[model samples]
Target: MATLSYAAKDSRTMVRRNLKKALRYPSLTLTVVIMPIMMLLLFNYAFGTALGSGIGPSAAGGGEYIDYLAPGIILMAATSGALTTAISVCVDKTEGIVDRFRTMPISRASFLTGHVVGSVIQTMTSITLVIAVALLVGFRPDATPVEWLAAIGLLALLTLALTWLSAGIGLVAKNVETASNIPMPLTFLPFIGSAIVPPESMPAGLRWFAEYQPFTPIIETLRGLWLGTGIGSSAAIGLAWCVALTVVGYLWARRTFKAGAKR
Candidate 1:
């Protein structure tokens, strides 16, 4: 009982440390917030007319398209923000910070816990900013208060999964550049998924991959919650994926960290 309490307390301390570092630096967090907003603007203004036409006549221009695009762009914000976790973790590993921590009596779990929790908080903040910009640009969700809560909860789960995966990547990466680059695919996976266009619009091979990829179901689930589209099996599948990713990431990160500590 006491051990669990102490671990929790230590994790909170680490979370605060990471959050303070983010506030002091701010550049990475700013990039996380800005990229999604820029993408939202570009797609809504430059291509909204052309692309929205395909979705529906009403969707043409920035009108209905923003509604469709906002969820995906918001998810992208989460993905982009998750990258910071890997970079920060790699920085700590490279700078001998972890080695220093090893000498302390703190809980080993707290280090990774801190990074993942802190990244999730930052990612969600970025998502909130993206959603705000989306609303400003005419992205209207048809969700009730309950649906809004569910959607936010789902987004938080997705962010948690991605942050854990990023933590594992950070532990394994040989350098900060590699750590940063490894998670790049995650940010753009939505482009290939139902995030931007229906998989039915793609060629057979590409569409197959797009539909099966983890992000597609997630985006579909979010779209359903926010826009009242058919969720079908996406909510269940997305939840499964989040759980699976969290388990995989947590195990991998713990194993890698343990291996390093032994050395």
Candidate 2:
């Protein structure tokens, strides 16, 4: 009981440390917010009409392209912040910060916990900003209060899972550049999913991949919750993906951290 309490305190301290670092150097956080807003504007104003027509009437939630595109772009906001986690972790490792932390009388678990918690907070803030922009640009959803809560919960879960994965990547990366590039696929994977267009519009091979990928179900679930579309089994599948990813990431990061500590 006492140990758990101490661990919690240590983790909070680390979270504060990371959050302060982020405030002192706001570039990464700004990028996380800006990139999604850029994509949202580009797609909504530049190609909205053409793409909206291409997606057909039913797929666009019977409304403008922004309505259909908002959920996916919001998910992009959640993902775009992942790169910062990997880079920060790598930078700490390369700068011998981890070595210094090891000598401190702090909970070892708090190191990664701090990074993940701090990141989730920052990423969620970015998501909120993106959502505000989305609303400003006519991205309206018919979601109820309960649905909004559920959607927020799911986004938080996804952010936590991705942050852990980024931590693992940082642990194993040979350099900061490698760490930064490794999570790039995650940032853009939504484009290949049901983000912009439905899988029905894709060729057979690409459609198969898009349907089975993790992001598609998640986006579908969000769409259903926000736009009154059919969720089917997407909510369950998305939750499963979040749990599976979180488990895998946690195990991988724990193992890698332990190995580094031993060496």
Candidate 3:
């Protein structure tokens, strides 16, 4: 009972703290909200039409190009949030906020939990906005209610995994600027994979990379869920990646935090 109470209390406190920070920085919230939508609109209406004709809508999965692209955009939005979370954590560490927290009697997990929860909430809002814009531009998900829920569950898992990875970067980043730079590769990774366009259209070398990369599996799983398509090995791969990354990142972050505490 005490454990349960501690868990509940920690969750509540963390969420409240994060929300207050978000409210204080309205511009950050706006940036997080608008950037994803802009990327969606720019890619879909502008570039998608040109690429759609060549890929042939059917070859690209028989759906509208925007629909095909929506999953990637959602993932991109989540990635952005994760990157922001890492940078925020790094900043807090440098600003002595983390040190202050370390002095408290609260659970160490509470500090990380609050930031991850806050980031997930922020990412979800960004995703909703992107989806709304995608709808306006004729993107639609054909999945049933259950499938939709599962898709959302996968996204949440993906977000949590990435947030943990980012937290590790935050714990070790030499400075705030360097911390933000760490997630750049991940931010650009989806674009290189089959997220925006099918891998078949790319050069053979690029195709190989796109087909084999972690982003492909994630994008594929999301696409299948959104479009009500048959599940493939990609979903399994995505789940594996999420599990592996989360475990490794959690262990590393904990170790780094412990070392930092001694310093």
Off by over 4 Å in 2: none
In candidate 1, position 8 carries an lDDT of: 100
Q: Model 3 compared with the native: what TM-score? A: 0.93
Which candidate has the top score in lDDT?
2
Better of 1 and 2 by lDDT: 2
For each candidate, give its TM-score against the true structure. Answer: 0.97, 0.99, 0.93
Clashing pairs in 2: none
Candidate lDDT (C-alpha), each: 0.89, 0.94, 0.81
Ranking by lDDT: 2, 1, 3
lDDT of 1 by residue, 1-263 (tens): 99999999999999999999999999988987999999999999999877777887332223488787888898898889878999999999999999999899999999999999999998998899899999999988888999999989988998998998999999899999999999999999889987776788799999999999998898888888888887899999999998999888889899999999998
**Span of ten consecutive residues with least summed lDDT in model 3:** 53-62
Clashes of each: 0, 0, 0
Which whole-number lDDT from 0 to 100 does residue 95 have in model 1?
98
Number of the candidate with higher TM-score, 1 or 3: 1
Evaluate residue 80 in candidate 2 and report its C-alpha lDDT on the 0 to 100 scale: 90
Model 3 alpha-carbon drift over 4 Å, by segment:
1-4
